[model samples]
Target: MPDIERKFKCSSVPYPPIISCIALLISMRAITWIGFIIWLVIRLIIYFIYGRKHSIVQNESKD
Candidate 1:
């Protein structure tokens, strides 16, 4: 898999156009901005819930 990925740059090549299409779709209102807002809120909530517990900096500070 690493050899194939290196030979083709498969990991990086496919993502940019997919991201661009999604961005364009969102800008054109095909996907709805409200859904994006909700997605962001959920991401923030999950990060607040889980990120602090696993943070290396916070654990190191405690020591």
Candidate 2:
């Protein structure tokens, strides 16, 4: 009988794209903050609307 070993590999982005992404973030500082705030508001609204309805505590209280 022979023993065999399996290996897993992962891929990563090259340095060029990584540098471009950092540059973009630095260039769009104001827009980035605005977008972040908008995203947070939307997420909070969703959590209050649909998330709370489907929560375990709410379900338990219903019974």
Candidate 3:
């Protein structure tokens, strides 16, 4: 079970950084704060949706 959980956990770790990096690069080129804000909102939404579900607390409860 932990091994399966690790696979899910490992996959998500790279996404946030990659997304933020892309957002930062685009904002730099476009010279607009909106793109960064959009990215932040997206990240927050993802956190609320997926992050909460995969949290340690939630996993502990499952056991």
> For residues 1-63, what per-residue lDDT tens digits would candidate 1 score against the true structure?
544545444568788999999888767773567788899999999999798998999999999
Ranking by TM-score: 2, 1, 3
Most accurate candidate by lDDT: 2
Model 2, runs deviating above 4 Å: 1-14, 29-32
- Model 1 alpha-carbon miss at residue 20, Å: 7.5
Predicted structure 3, TM vs. truth: 0.40
Model 3 segments more than 4 A misplaced: 1-31
Candidate 2, residues 1-63, lDDT tens digits: the string is 245664753456487788998888888878778999999999999989897889998899889
Go through the candidates in order and give each one's C-alpha lDDT: 0.82, 0.84, 0.80
In model 1, pairs of residues that clash are: none
| Candidate 2: 10-residue stretch with minimal lDDT | 1-10
Position 51, candidate 1: lDDT: 82
Q: If candidate 3 were superposed on the true structure by all CA atoms, what would the RMSD be?
A: 13.0
